[model samples]
Target chain A: MNDTPHIQLKGVKKRFGSKLVLDGVDLTIRRGESVVIIGGSGTGKSVTLKCVLGILRADEGSIHVAGEDVTRASGSKRDAYLRKFGMLFQGGALFDSLSIWENVAFGLIQGRGLPRKQARETAIEKLAMVGLSADIANLSPAELSGGMQKRVGLARAIAANPEILFFDEPTTGLDPIMADVINKLIASTVRDLGVTAVSITHDMVSARRISSRIAMLYKGRIIWDGPTDSIDNSGNPYVDQFIRGSAEGPIRMEVRS
Target chain B: MSANENILSSNWNIFAAIGRVVLAFLAGTGRLAVFAGIAISHIVRPPIYWQLVLHQMLRIGYFSLPVVGLTAFFTGAVLCLQIYIGGNRYGAEAFVPQIVVLGITRELGPVIAGLMMAGRVSAAIAAEIGTMRVTEQIDALTTLATNPFKYLVVPRIVAAVVTLPILVAVADSIGVFGGYIVGTRSLGFNGAVYINNTMNFVTAGDVRSGLIKASVFGFIIALMGCYSGFHSKGGAQGVGAATTQAVVSASILILAANYLMTSFFFSE
Candidate 1:
């Protein structure tokens, strides 16, 4: 894997009407590095990821994916750029109408236009990588448990063996054991595939386990960025309050009745 | 303190609110237009998902047939009975076959089937996608380099457009048969005469027009469901609202479009 940054964002800003979701965000992900973004709920962690993916166009600034300017790339060019990244959604986002193997092979069959039989075989292979049995490939996503669904989602994300992987709260709804398992799987998969990974999570343990570097997002800006081992002693107040899960901190939840 | 003045003021306020709502709706519709254009562009490009399209065709089109069929059958029967009663008083009982054929083939079958599908398919699409949106599945698709429009919306629209016409065709045939069954069995008409008269009075134009309407209605239903669900906000409440809006909007559009198409096809 190359040592240069695979994904880079500079001065990216996104606003929804009067409320700014991502305000002048800047970040960089080195090739084959796992960077987990940590933030409170509604702190623009997801927005940051979206900006990078070009799902939500930045109001201002630049996004470079694999050294190509993506902020302004539209249509096929953006789509071509997108093929290099894999994302695991928070809820797995499996098509309920499709079986497990079909869901896993969605990118392979639909996005890549592979033959059904070949796609099914590839889907089963990916599923096996996520520790799922081939027997479960015929089942609908609705038939699976939450953890299984996440595994299927993981299988789907890596099906294409993308250069960059994005995980949006992958461990959110899973049990502690499942979350840890996912974290380990993510860690090992990143290592094995040598793919650049970016994840956003409120779970500090997950962030620590899956990430080589951690970034704390606050007020739509990344307040601190450092290696996983240096997070505890980052000496940044916002990072300190967030990692400790303190109610009294620079971050306050918005409450309305 | 006058009643007329109070009523006038209330009406004025209502109109003003309605004006504001109309403007907002137009603005939102404009945004949807742009989104739809983006979605369409994705449809023609590479990375087409034929399997997803087939899957959606089965889900949105094939699964919806029974309800559309049942609704059309009942509607045709009732229309025939009402026409029979009215024609009997006027000594115009011979008109029963003609009116029933026209009613089912030109208006009833497509509109009724479309409305039923709007209720069933639109709500299903909205609820499924809205839930996914609230839970961040859509976002996940984005990260996976999967265009949600291509992966989610395009297949649905295509399936609906393709399947709705077939369903409407089946419903139209079944509905006319229903009127025939009722006209002959209950209204004491000669079975052969009813069938022959129905056939002779009904032109290919009527059936074709109904199927055309069905195609348009299908697109409208799927589009509304997808648009509402894709843009759904809030959480559970937002998703619920999206589902309700999708069904209601699709149904109303089907009716409105039916009237417009009817006038266009048959107006003097």
Candidate 2:
């Protein structure tokens, strides 16, 4: 095993104006490991991921990816760092104006300067891997169903064979069967590609199925971190309260914001 | 908690509120200026997406022909009719053709076309980009190693800068033809004499200045649209606000810029 973790965050703190979203977040993921951060709504899981991606800067703390300090990097250095990451946004976030194939081929053609024709071919192949046919390639993303859009998003994320993949609530806004299919696809994709993944989700079933390890976030801190199998017996009230989906537990819902 | 103290604090709060509003407005202006600077800097760089620029040109310029042409024609006809009626009182009715050509070529053509496009193109841009922002497509582009400014803003800016002048030229030709129609038919002037009067009286400088105004107006329209859209937050309401801001600001800036350019070009 490598001495240094593939992705590391130490005391990552971020605040938007008066509200502190991420307060002293610390975590590490080994190479080829899948870590899913589980939390309730507005728990700052997305903020942590965005901080690592350099989309949002942490007010305090250091984020290192592949031994490079991503927080301070700028310009082409930052762009080079970003090239290693592939993200599946919660909503798929596919460009509505572009055809499905063009969305998948976007990174290759734009970032890698690949020829459009070659990129399109590669995109079709990726779509096939995600169980989509080439016939739907020319259709705009708006024409597809939510589940299909998610599949296209997955295809796009893995199209470039990136080193690190970030899935932001991959199963969000989907039915149970479709969500399971997506989870299986994600698990297989990550396993086959052997890429490091950090996902944020509230879906416990998804966390258990897609990740080797689970970290539960509460009040802007990681309350517990351990292997997925050990999660059931972790003996943490918050984790138990969250996993069981119980209303009467140590975790109290603040109804009035 | 005393009544006098409460009144004093309320007055102080009002002053603070005013100060905050002014400060926020200034800060927004400063941020927009910086954004404009960065966008202009990228204009000279490689990886210029000519295909996207061409598509935007077709969207912003080619599709705008009918509306711009119609507006210019009507405006020119009205200006000729009004000048003929008004100039008759001063026994200078023959000046209609010259002034109508000058008005269409120099001022009314560019300004009207600018305001029209500001309403049409700017709002659409702001709405589209705003929706993209809210949906995280902009962030998705970033993760793919694509700079949103280079991919989105640059192409639109280039297209506007290139196409607005062309649109203005089209409007100018149509506007002159409109004036010619009114002059020969309604005013009973000889068609050949009207054409000769227009050709001989309007200088090349007038057309050049109008085109210059159109280009600057183009830059303003696209810049506002992209700026508002990029900064948009929340959801559909934010997109709506961005669209309104884009059109309103672009129109105001176009008129203001026209004033500056007009004074610079035609001032004594």
Candidate 3:
């Protein structure tokens, strides 16, 4: 394994109009590590992920992936940069107009121009990898349940065999049992693929299960970052408040503002 | 601090307000023009989704024909009756066939069909693309290495530009037939004479001009639709707002462009 970090962000700042969403977020992750970013609602967690992916550019920062600067990359450079990433969107974000297998095979056929037949076969294989059966291949995304949709989304993410994977609130809005199922699948996928994984979620149970290392984002900065086992004994008030799911302490919930 | 200075300041405020409004309008026009330029450029570029373009043609062009035809037919019939009513005072009722055919072929066919297609197709594009935008499907497309402008935008634009002229051609025939029906049946005119006058007076110049207007109107409709939807935010209300704006802007631009084109084509 290379000792250098696979991804690095330095002094990233992002603002939406007058509101400063990400003040100055800096984080780094080595190759083949699953880093889950835990944060409260409206804490700019998704924005951080988006900035890293170049979906939303940072106002001030430097982001490097595999030693290549991609802060303002566009055109073919951006496309090539994106080819290394596979994202499972918070809402699955599956193309509603396409069928299940077609949704899974979308990046392949549309982006890579692979033959539909070959793409469908790989799509089904990916679906099976995510514990989905072959029967649901013909069904539309809307026909599937929320959990099933997320599984399909995961299948799509891994279909291309990307070196990096991003999960935006992967287990959000799922029952505990189903969430656990997804969490286990994600853990195994990251382990087996040996790919770097970055996820954002408020679900501590999920964050704890899926990540080897955990980073807590507060006010657009990583406030607490450590190995998953040490999260409880981190001795930080914010970390304690967040992990315990408490509304008290130094962490204040903005209610009725 | 002084009375004269206060009055001057208040007057300056009005001037500033006017300047701000004008500047905003100019900025908006510039942005829309740039978006349209990019969409046009994308049309001639590689990686054009020909399949999606054909699909959009069916949706925007073929699906919109019935409404366009129905509106044109009624517009032509009404124009004939109105012209007959007005021409009766001047003893020019015999000119109804020539006037109706010319009006339908040159103005009402393209304008009415353009407006109808704007309402039907522009709103649909805005709603569909707006939903995709709000749902992060557009971002997903980016992550998947697909260009949203090419996949979601260019197809609708190409389909609209290519199909609207064909639609207007068909609508022109239907509108003339409508005038013929009302003229021969309702206005007590001889069928053979009405057909003869209509055929003789309607030149290729008139029909070609209208088809040209239809193509221009098509570009406006798709541009407004794609532009509004591409920038849509704030979820359901945003999508709703975009759909409304697409239809309104497309309709207004169609009419405005019709005036400009008409002046250019017939100012002589």
Tell me, what's the RMSD of every candidate?
Answer: 3.6, 1.7, 2.0
Q: Top DockQ: which candidate number?
A: 2
Q: Residue B32 in candidate 1 has what lDDT?
A: 75
Q: Scoring each candidate complex against the real one, what DockQ results?
A: 0.53, 0.93, 0.84
**Candidate 1 falls in which docking quality class?**
medium
Per-residue lDDT, model 1, residue A48, is 88
lDDT tens per residue, model 3, A40-144? 999999999898788899999889998889999988999998999999999999999999999999999998999999999999999999999999999999999
Docking class of 3: high
lDDT of 1 at B35: 71
Per-residue lDDT over B1-268 for candidate 2, one digit per residue giving the tens place of the 0 to 100 score: 6999999999999999999999999998999999999899888887788999999999999999999999999998999999999999999998988999899989999999999999999998999999999999999999999999999999999999889999999999899899889888989999999999999999999999999999999999999999999999999999999999999999999999999999999897
**Top model by TM-score, which number?**
2
Looking at model 1, residue A118 earns an lDDT score of 97
What TM-score does structure 1 among the candidates reach? 0.89
TM-score of chain B of each: 0.91, 0.95, 0.96
Q: Backbone clashes per model, in order?
A: 0, 0, 0
Q: What's the lDDT for candidate 1?
A: 0.87
lDDT for model 2, on a 0 to 1 scale?
Answer: 0.93
Model 2 docking category: high
